[model samples]
Structure formats: structure tokens, C-alpha cells
Target: MPAPGSAALGVDEPRSASAIVGATVTGHHLLHIDGYSRTKHKLPTGQFIKSLPFSVGGRSWCISYYPNGLRSEYADFVSVFLHLDKSAGEPVKARTKFCLLDRAGKPVPSNTSTTEPYEYLPGGVGFGIAQFISTAFLEKSEYLLDDCFKITCDIIMSEELRTEDRIAASPFVAVPPSDLNRHLGDLLAAQDGADVTFQVAGETFRAHRFLLAARSPVFKAELWGTMKESAATMVSLRIDDMLPQVFKALLHFIYTDSLPEMEGQEEAVMAQRLLEAAVRYGMPRLKLICEDRLCRHLDVRTAATTLVLAEQHNCHGLKEACIEFLKSPRLLEAVVETDGFEHLTKSFPALVKELMCKLAAH
Candidate 1:
């Protein structure tokens, strides 16, 4: 019983033409319409924006424009606003949820969002923002967006929902540097009954003096037991015997996670000790450091020592590195002159044979 234009203005009765246009054109693709007015005032600039329905993982989503639309200039206007509901619910914030894509349509890591901004040009051809809402939120919430409309609402969410959920549930706990230092100091203080203190890397520990008393077999056995039981006990002790020092260093690292410093040292002696320790303890990092130093400071005698350590430690990698120093023409000639070739042949027959064969072939 209403007037003729009442349906168009929601005051008069139903109109066939308006209903037909509204029914047929519902979709996500940007519609190019000329002179379409929504209200009775007949505004020229107004346009209806709808999103294409996308299905990801069997869930549906409805995307829509923000209330303020492009006028808000919030930089995310072109981006599709997402909601699970087909009816009415407050739309979640989309900026933090949307995946930004690059020119090639590759999803950019979110960290890059801070540095980059997208600009919309004059033509209708421009990138649109796509935001994702979690399925858990959709499942638990009471409200729903209008599912009857097929064009604008598509549910495509990322598989990272589980990871995001875990990250949200657990919070990070920060520890102060001073507290860590205090705890380390307490650990250092606990070993008061020791004599010599040897620090390797940043770790400090105590050592009993008698353990390093030269030629004391009893003390050596006891120290060896301690080394076997807890290799880290040597961090505080300096045993003058190179062999024992190497063994203790290696054992200490194996039992207690610590690395000894390579400062000072009789260069050749320390290199040999460190090399031996590296091999024994299976410390690849320490081994590489020792090998580099030895290579720089190589002499005929040290090369011989390195060769022996390489073989003893079964360090194939270190052996190959040491071979570079030992196979040098100068070092090889020095070995021949010093009658050290015999020692080398005796210790590393395979290497000596290989070197001899290469020399003969050359």
C-alpha cells in the first residue's frame, strides 16, 4: 500500500528494476557503475564496495569496507576488511591481520610493512588489501556476517594459526644481565678449596695445586679421576705438563661445557696442547682455531707435532689442514736436512709415502 518509488527510498512500495540490479551484480570484483545513488538525496560520488568470497580450509569469510572508507586515509583502505560472520559483529582490526603483497604478488614478510607503504593510483586497477581472521575466533564467537551474499565474503585463512595461537598463549620472561653475572660469581665462589685458577673463554673455576705437582704419580691419578668424572674441574687449574694439560682441557670440555683460552703460551707448545685437546674433546671450533694459529706460526718441528696430533686425534679434517703446512717445500726440505723425515715416516707412513710419491711424480 506504499507509493511507486517507496522501495528504492525504503519508503514507497517494491520496485522491479532496483531489485533486479541488486540481485544480479553481487560479487567481489570492483564494479564500474555510472551515476548510481544510494540515498534519496542522489549523491553522485557514492559507490557500493563489496568483496569476493574466498574459501580457504573450508571456512567462509565476509570482507567489507571500513565505515570511514578511503576518506580515513589510514593507508589500509584498499585492503579488504575481514570478518567470519555473515550478519553483524564488530569487525576486528585488519591492518595487523592482512598480508601485504609485493608487485609480483608475493606475500611480503610483515616486518617489511614498517618500511614500505602502498599508493593507490588514479585508475581502478590497483592492489587491494586482504586480511585474515582466525578460525578459532569464528568458531567461538556468537555473531556471524551475512553468508547469503556470495560475492563479498570469502574465507581464506593462513595455516600459521597454530603458531600464532602458541605465541599468544606464552609470554616472554626477560632476565637482567646483573642477575646472570651474580649467579656466575656465586658459582666461582663455590670452589674456594682450590689453588690455581684457570679461566678458559669466559668461565672461571678452581683447581687443587697438588694435582699439577710435577711427576707426582699419585696426584696425577687422582686428577685423572676428576677429569674423567668432571672434565670441567680443570677450568681453575694450570698443570704445567703439556700432555696432562691437553688431556685435562679436553676432558674438562667433554664433562663440563667450557673452552680454554689460547692466550700467552710457548707458541709451539701451546699449539700442540690445544691441538691435542681439540682432538680429544671433539671440539671442532677449538680445533679450527688451533689449526689456524699453528699454520701461521708453523716450523718444521711444530709441523711434526701437529702431524702426530692429527693422527692421534683421528681428526681427518685437521690432518688435511696440517698437511698444507707440512707439505710446504721449505718445511719438507727442512725436515730432510734435520733428519726429521725419518721421524715423520715413522709416525705417518701413509702421509710420508703420499708426499714422496707426489715429489717423485713432479
Candidate 2:
């Protein structure tokens, strides 16, 4: 058995500290083994040495070998190196490099004769490193020492295991209610003088108010009913019941027709507000956004309230989502124990009673 760091037959030691030695030929290629030696030895007739050279901790070494005389010429030559770093307080690194050599002991330059570096971390974990030299560089004899160094740095960083401390914390920090209200005031103030025009169902309407008053089904039925009777005609119906601040936001969306950028906890609130406005104004798209946000952001407590609101306004989708949320066994118990459930049950007695019975069966 070949010892670690020893070269196989017909392989030579690397010429430099950083260079990796690999196979001179690939697959089954017969070649004559003229001679082989490790520490400065001469080769026989057809035999030559191939090696990969690398240095770690201020020490350099190579791995080389000789081929069998009777081996078929189809056998290619390969050199393997085992690198060990013993620097104090430093990581241990190991890698392999390959090269192709001709019968006359010369490197056979080609796309296939490239070197790839692999790494072993401190804890015996292993991974592949990036390619040191590009194929173009090899073909043109353009040395990419600088590129290799850059790649080495990248590999070191890549191999460094990530701890929780290094990872970025969530940007969704909690915001004080005062700050939230202040931000809402600023949003509303920004749209104080804006006018927006939108079509609900089929009728077009214009409003200077920042809030989507048409979102209220009651208001939509009263005002837009005369324009078109078909449900499809309610295309541009605006929502009106959105909170004053939320209405301002909806108005902003109607005019700009773009999402409002927000950060942290504000994102959920803004999304919820926008969804409510969308649902109220008969904006199917915005309603969908709200549904997604409610599903993702609202906790069981808030979801129960949203359920009541949804049912009150005949928002079937929202109601269904709420029902699904409340169906969770753990959450159902929590909901039953809350004052909010009592209010919801009293408000939608039939629906809540039925839901409670269904939950009991589960």
C-alpha cells in the first residue's frame, strides 16, 4: 500500500510551494516507465516523474512516482499530494492537485490538465475550493497568480463555518405604538392634497379624499349601484372603511398603483391595511395581498378579530382563512378562552356557534 504524501509510479514532485500536481494522462494509456525516484533521483528510458508542489506553515513538499515498465501506454500518469498545516492557533488545511506529463517529462498543457483545490476544515469537514486558473489562462500561458490569490481568500472565507453571531438578525424589529402612529400621520400628511380617480366594477368615480371611502360595501352599493348592476361592473369600486391612515395609504396606492415601501413590523401592518383597503374598494389584487399577509403575519388573537370583521363585511375569503386558523386545536382552545371570542360569537352568533360545534368534534 502506498504511504500518505508518497507519489505513485511515473509521477514527479511539484516545482513550487503552491502548485498542485495531478495526472499526466487520463484513462487507460500505456506508457513506458523509464525510472522513478522520490528525493532527487534519475529516470530510466521512457519513465518520468510528475509532481504537485505546495507549501503550508513555511514548509514545501512534493509527491512523485514511477510507472510500471510493462504497463500499457494507455495508462495516464497522476500525482497526488497530502498537505498538512500545523501552525499554532490556525486551521489545518489539506488539498489535492493534478497535472499531466508527457513521455519526455514535460507538462501537457490542455483544458483537461487543470488544477482544482479542495479544503478540509479544522473539525475534519471537507469541501471543494474554487478553480485556481481559468482554461483561457492555461491555453495562452497567461498566469493568473492574482486571480488564484483572490480565489484562495474566497475559499478561506467560504470554508469558515458560520455561527449564529455572524448571521444577520431579523430586520423585523418591534415598533412602539407611538412611532407607528407618528409614521401613519406622516403618510396621511403626504397625501393631503392628492386626488385620485378609479373605476369600481364598471362605474368610474373621482375623489379628492385620501381614504378609499368606496371600500365600504354599504357605500359602494348606495353610490355605484346606479352605474352598473353586474358584479363585474364593480371593477374600480373604492373601499371606504379603511382606517383614516389606512385609507390615505390606499389612496396612495390607487393613484400611484404601486406598493408602499416599509420596514420591520410596519410591513405587516401596512400590508394588512392595504389588503383591507383592497377588499373594501373591490380591488381583487389588493385583497389577495391582504389575504397572504393575514395568513403570514396575524397571530391567533388578531386573526379572530379579523375573522369577525371579515364576516361582518361579507368578505368570504377572509372569513375562510380565519376559520381555518381558528380550527387548530391549540388555537381553538385559546380562542374559546378569550373575550374576543365572546364578542365574535355574539356578533355572528350563527357562524360562531356552528364553528364551535365543528371544532368540538375535532
Candidate 3:
């Protein structure tokens, strides 16, 4: 009654390849320990207070807080752990993070610990940091307010399900990554919708006023505020003391939120100049990027110069990196012989004194 290649004969039916659906489930729990001092004095090492059971990734979980350490060897530290309250049919893969909360209940970055994904067997001592924080530090820090403190446990579990749902061997269409930056970069290249013009070192550059104002506070005031330049329909602003190339790069960043590729030696020069421009324009992220670039480029030849830039720009991380690089007596002696060190000593005598003091102590 049923023909071949027909539904009734089952030949026309599509075959489904098995597909495994997987996702990560994330959950966080906050445990507040009141009378922290009493707990530390009363609860001996290896004793813990258990949190109420919570659910994540379709499984029950809880946190174990040890005021004193979990073991006598770690008695000077506080410990935290994540425990799987429910038994699993197979080993579960998960990531765990523990964070000490500040007085405002926000997680302190310096006191957070994150773990890589680990396979957890049921009934085993769950994965966590044994020495989350030293007891001495806890007592001295502002985190322990009114003899109380809080901690947050974040858990991410990888869960998989085997299903019979049919899917194509390959997708019918592949979505591409975002091209917003590319489009904006093209817009900059095309000079379309540009309303502002800048004359820097006898060079002309065109840019959009709204984009510049949106990106930088200094640009906002210069273009949109009560400055005389803001009243013009097509404003022509003259920039003094900046190189045409640096100004061009700054416009590119305003449009694309990224820097163009440059040669190795040119990149360092560009980074230093861009850092100055970033500071002048109140672009904190770009300033940080330049500071990081300069830090990586530090050497005996460039250490003192980088330190001077860092000091003038108030880039603490870069300054510290430069100081660390110049700490060795051999390196210091070599750097002190450079002309950059002469400029640094003349410009930032206080910084030079600080470095000398640190070197003496070392």
C-alpha cells in the first residue's frame, strides 16, 4: 500500500544525528559571619559553619566557612570551601570563586580567588582555597567591621544533556563577528559626516564633532560647551605642540576605539606620545594601554625616561615597573650613565630620591 521513498515506507524520513546540549549554570551565595572575633576565639582549627543549602546547575550546594584554618598547619589563616550537597551519578565539572566582601558589601579584588574547572567526585572534599586570607590581615583590615564580615561564593557548573533533537551537520548560515569598528574606521577614512577640522603642525585633519565629544570630556567642552569654538557650524580648531601623526592616531582611536598597527620602534614613540594625549583628553583606558605598552618596553636605555613619563602622568603601575626594572645595582649603574637619567633627575628629584632610598634598602 505504501510506495518506496514515501513517508509511509519510512525511506523519506530524515535521520537525526545525536546532539549533546551543554551550558554553564552560575550562582552566588553570600555568607555573613557576625561576631567574627568570637568565632575565631571559640571555633578551633578544623571546625566550620555550614551555609544553608542552595541550588546551582540543578544540584544542591553549600559553603563551608572556617574561621580558623581547616587544618592546624594553616591555623593563622581563614578558609572557605564549596561543597556539593547532592550526590552526582558521575563526576561533575565546575569552577569556584571565593571573595571577601568589603564594608559596602562589594567583593574586594585583592581578596578574591578563582579556580580553574575541576572534576569533583561525589562525597569528596570539595575544591576551594585553604588559606583564603590570613587571620592577622583580617583583623587589621576594614573588611571586619563591627566584628562582622561577609564572603561570597560563586560557582559555575558545566552541565550536559543527551537529546534526540535533530540538527544540521553544519549551520545553514554562519554569523560573523561584529564589524562596528570596521564600519567606523571606514567612516573616518571616507570623511563622511565630518564637521570639525583640526590644524596641527601645518597638517589638516577632519573628524566628527559628536564622536569626539562622546569619547573625551576635553573634546566635549571644546566642541559642545560654551567655548567660542562651539558656536561655529564648521569649527576649525588649531592644535599646538602635538605632532600631526599623533593627532591623526588620536582621531582614529576616537572613531574606532583601537590603535592602528605600527613598526616596533615607532610603536614605543607612539605609545609615549599617545599617553600624553590620553592624559590631556581624559581618556583613562587609552592612558592605561599606553602605560602598559611603555612598561613592557622598559630597559636600561629606556627605564629612566619611562619613569619620568610615568611620574609626570601619575601612572603608578608604570612607575613601579620602572623602579623594579632599575633596582639591580648593575642595571642602575648602567641607567644612571644615560642622558635620560640626567633629565629624570632634573625633572623629578623627589622620584630619584625615592628610587635611591629603595635601592639602598634593597
Candidate 4:
């Protein structure tokens, strides 16, 4: 049928349909069954009831049930499934919960009473119970209403998206650098214009009165109150008990919230001394660090001393760690022969009793 100068016709454009945008909407979808028992004897292998399709939060979903079970392994139990029919982009995650309805049209009590979350991958991915409940249990169970059982799936949708900025996101910037520690360190380093000094053994350490007062309430009372250290312009506070190195480490901890590593026997010994000094100055964080270090270095040789120190300062963590290390009869027997053991037994007898109680319980 050839025609000269003739043009073919085309259909007109249809009206535009509205599309969703912005943040992914969220909602819960429910799929209910009326006579669940009616499908109880469908097929022994597996069967899907008329696929009840549901659309929620811009995704397609389907609910199905298998009477004799989904797999041979689950043949003794009834199985239910939640399937992702269609998804716009990447896999979407949703939670599904199945229920057995009573005659009152409410959920019946059954072992299948929990929410199951699943990732619906692109193409299709599904999740469900392979062994929900035995058929014998459900058949006689009061869950059936006129031999009708119902199931409800609560579909929870979420906006799981990756924006351009999220692809290479910056780490959280929580705490900005501040002058509190650095400036305090400056006061410790520059000792120029310092107003206070501490004498340990024969060494004199330069310090600031306000710095000590700000750090420790004990120092505040001694440096500014009726104490003799308050009166002098360049105050000299005498501490006869502590060594020069231990006292220096305490000042470092006050300026910088850190401590030296527990390297060897000497540093471990130094840590014990520093912990007591920290306790005297009301530095709980320093004491906690010391406890952690001491716990790591615990041995038959040091366990007795660390336990005594823990008891004296009420450092419960260090005390418990000491007791735990002594759980070995060999270690405990060796610890009893150490010189520190004799000292601890003589000084802190109550701690000995407490250790005995914990070991007995163990």
C-alpha cells in the first residue's frame, strides 16, 4: 500500500505522574491472614499462598507461608517468609514479625513471637523462619480461631542512603586543642616567675602556688590557708617522705594527663610510689592508670606489695587483680615467701582475710 507524500501518525503524550523525592519516607506495613489453618494442609513440600503484595516506603514486598514447611529439615514445623519483590536502588533493610491471631482478632501466644530484621538485596533477598512451630503444637494450640490462623508482619522502613559527602566522610572533630594543658605545661617548663618550691630529700623543685592550689584541694588549703606555706613570698613546702623523681613525676601528671610506661622493674617500683603520691594529691585518674600498670606487671615478687598498696589506698581494681593473680596455688605459695608478704601480713591482716574469701568463692 504505497502512498505519495503521506505522514505516519503518533500517539499524544500522556499526563505526568507525581514522583517522590527528598528523604526516604518511613512507615510500618501489616499483612494479615484470616484462616491460617485453611492453608495448613496445602502441600508437604512447600507452597506460597496467594502472594499478598504490599508497597511501603517506596519498596515492593511479599508475604508467604509454607504449611508442611519450607525445607525438609523444617518439615515438622510451619514456616513463613518475607520477600523483597522490587527495590529502587541498593538493598533495603526491614524487620518482619509474624504472629498467630486468636478469635479476638489479636495475636495468639506462640514461640514465634519476635521481630526479625533482614536485608533485602537488589534483585531479591528474603528472610523468614524455617522452623517456626511444630504442626502438632499449632493444630491443638488455642491460637486457631475456627481453624483459622492469622499472621501480621510489622515492616519497619528506614532511609539508608549514601550521599556524596558520606562517601569520604571526615572523622568527627570532638575536642578542639585548648590552652589549659599547654599553658599549664608552659608554667611547669618556664619556671621563670614561679612563686613556690617543694623540697624533697635534698633537691628543691620550682613550681607555682596557683598551679598547685588549682590542681589539688589539699595543696589549696596548705598554700593559701593558715598553713605556714601561705605566708612567704617564695614559699618552701617540705615533703620529707617522697623521693625527688617520684615527686617530679607527680607534677608532670598534673600538667599533662599522661604517665611513663611500665618498662622494667625500676619503672614498676617507681609507679607504685607515684600511685601513693597521686592518691595523696586527690588524683584519681592517675591512680587508675597506676592500677592498670601494676595489674599488668603483677608477679609473685610484686604482687604482695601491690596488694598492700591497693588496700592502703582503697584501690579496689588493683586489689581484685592481685587476688586474681594469686589464684594459682604455685604463685600464692611463692608470694608467701617474699619479704613483702611478711610486711603485708603484719600490716593489713584484714586484706589477707578478704583475699582468702575471694579464693574460697572461686
Best by lDDT: 3
Ranking by lDDT: 3, 4, 2, 1
Q: Clashing residue pairs in candidate 4, if any?
A: 36-149
Better of 1 and 3 by lDDT: 3
Candidate 4 regions exceeding 4 Å error are 1-183, 226-232
Question: Superposing all C-alpha atoms, what RMSD in Å does each candidate have to the true structure?
Answer: 23.7, 26.2, 20.2, 23.9
What shift in Å separates residue 313 of candidate 2 from its native position after superposition?
3.1
List model 3 lDDT by residue over 277-319, tens digit each: 9999999978987886676577888899999888888999889
- State which candidate, 2 or 3, has the greater TM-score: 3
Give Cα-based local distance difference scores for all models: 0.38, 0.42, 0.74, 0.65
Total backbone clashes of candidate 2, pairs 3 or more residues apart or in separate chains: 59
Q: How far is candidate 3 from the true structure (C-alpha RMSD, Å)?
A: 20.2
Q: Output the TM-score of candidate 2.
A: 0.34
Q: Please give the lDDT score at residue 284 for candidate 4.
A: 78
Model 4 agreement with the true structure over 229-317: per-residue lDDT tens digits: 34547877899789998998888777766553335676678879988888888877778777766776789899999999888899998
lDDT of 3: 0.74
- Angstrom error of the Cα, residue 41, model 1: value is 70
Candidate 1 segments whose C-alpha is farther than 4 A from its true place: 1-162, 165-260, 263-268, 277-296, 339-342, 358-362
Strongest candidate by TM-score? 3
lDDT of 4 at 86: 54
Candidate 2 vs candidate 3: which has greater lDDT?
A: 3
Clash number for each model: 23, 59, 0, 1
